[model samples]
Target: MTFRRQVMIILRRDLRIEGRSGEAIFVTVPFGLVALFLIPLALPLDIELLARIGPGMFWSVTLLFGMFITFRQSAAESSSQQEQLRMLGVDPAARFVGRAIASALLLLIFELILAPTMVVLYAPAAIPGWPAIIPLALLAAVGLAMIGTLAADITASLRSRSALAPLLVAPLSVPLLVPAAQGLESLRTKNGIMVPTMFMVAVVLALAVAGVVTAQPLEETT
Candidate 1:
């Protein structure tokens, strides 16, 4: 098969699996909802307070929830079937790209739900600039997907890989977390899409490049 075909195969496989399951809708997104619901309660019910901090809190929780699903997505990439893919001569790099793309798309959907959910729950005053928010969110979702998929392989062989996935992925994801939170916060503010947006895009691009370069070795090592 051609390289694009290989990537699409994995992408379709992962997307189809997610569509059939709705695990995010029923499970992880609710976990994010809990985080969203709690922040306002824990902080104060003050509208002003919520408006100030809600964007940051929303993105942080969304990332956490996204990472949770990311582990599951990468875990599915393994087993006899994955070995079979390799045996068939699908480039390991292509497989990574494909899986990352699928996982990124999955994460993207998950975030799309969580964003509005946050707005509903928190009711922040400075409405997010939808134009900037879309790309910012896309970056955050895909960046998390790439980073998490690559990290998942580190502990894939371990019996404890599920538990270990977060531990492995979280530190590396600090760059994503910082810029994402800041960008969302900025996007919600009057200045709109400026420095933080650029920072976030830069970080996502860096992670994408790094993940692509390292994906094969990481897969092999695990």
Candidate 2:
């Protein structure tokens, strides 16, 4: 198969798997909602404080969801599964591209739905402009997807790797989470997304490069 075709095939397969299972709806979305719901109960009920913390909380929940999806998706590729794919002559590069695409697509969908819900739940004083968030969210999703996928790949075969995956991803994802959180906060405060959005674009580029370079190594290790 052509490289692009291989990537598309895997992408479609992952998407189909996710769709038929309704895992995103039943598991992922509900998990996010539960996390979000707990924030109010866990923290003080001060409205202004909640509003101020809203953006940070929103991205934090997204991060946890991103990690959850990564861990689950990576679990799909057990050692036997990797051997099967390799025997079928799947290119590691194409596999990475396909996984990154599916991961980002799912994360984007989650954020799109969750963002509005968060606005309604916490930001009652002002409706943040949705347009400004588009570029930020898009870049953030891709960054999270790529980073999480790579982390999952790295830890997939190790003993206790399920427990290890998030630890590996957390530090690498600092660049992603920090900028996104700050940018969202900036959006809330200054109504501007240009600065942090630009930083996120850079982050996406860096992670994309890292994904490409590491895909083959990851597959080999798996």
Candidate 3:
């Protein structure tokens, strides 16, 4: 098969399996909702504070929740007899890219549901530019997918460490998160797309390139 066809095959297989299991979105959506609900409780119900922090809170909550789901999304596949089947049926590069796309799409779904609820609950003074937020979500999702998938692959072989996906994912994700945080914060203050958009895009591009390059040997080693 051609390279694009191989990638699509892996994508189809993952979506079908996730559809059957149903646990992936089951876990992700509620986690996102809880995270969204907690922000008001954690701080005083001060409108000023909420407005000041809402954008960051929105990004942080969604990103962290996404980390959880992205890590889980591929962990099962990498650990089982399915790993062998994947190896037989797909090239390692195709497998990695396909898995990344699936994880990114899942994250996007969570973001779509989470963002509007954040607007209603937190009542930000103004929503960020939709154009910018869309790209920001997409780029962050890609970065999260790459890093989360790699960490999941690393820990999947360890029976006891299955629960450690977040622990492993969060630290590595800071590079992505920092730029994202800054960008979102900028969105709070400004009208037009802010400078941090460039930083976030750069961070996502760098991590994605790194993930693609390192995935092969690491997949074998883990």
Best by lDDT: 2
Which residue pairs overlap in candidate 2's backbone?
none
C-alpha local distance difference test of each model? 0.75, 0.80, 0.74
Backbone clash count, each prediction separately: 0, 0, 0
Question: Candidate order by lDDT, highest to lowest?
Answer: 2, 1, 3
1 versus 3: better TM-score goes to: 1
For residues 89-190, what per-residue lDDT tens digits would candidate 1 score against the true structure?
A: 888778778878877877877787877887777677755455666777778888888887777666666788777888877787777778767765565556
Q: Give model 2's TM-score versus the native structure.
A: 0.90
Off by over 4 Å in 1: 73-75, 127-130, 184-192
Model 2, total clashes:
0
Arrange candidates by TM-score, descending: 2, 1, 3
- Each prediction's RMSD over C-alphas, in Å, is 2.4, 2.2, 2.5
My TM-score estimates for the predictions, one after another, are 0.88, 0.90, 0.87
As a whole number from 0 to 100, the lDDT of residue 184 in candidate 3 is 51
Q: Which ten residues in a row have the lowest lDDT in candidate 2?
A: 66-75
lDDT of 1: 0.75
Q: Give a tens-digit lDDT track for model 2, residues 86-144.
A: 99999998888898888888888889878888887887456357467677778888898
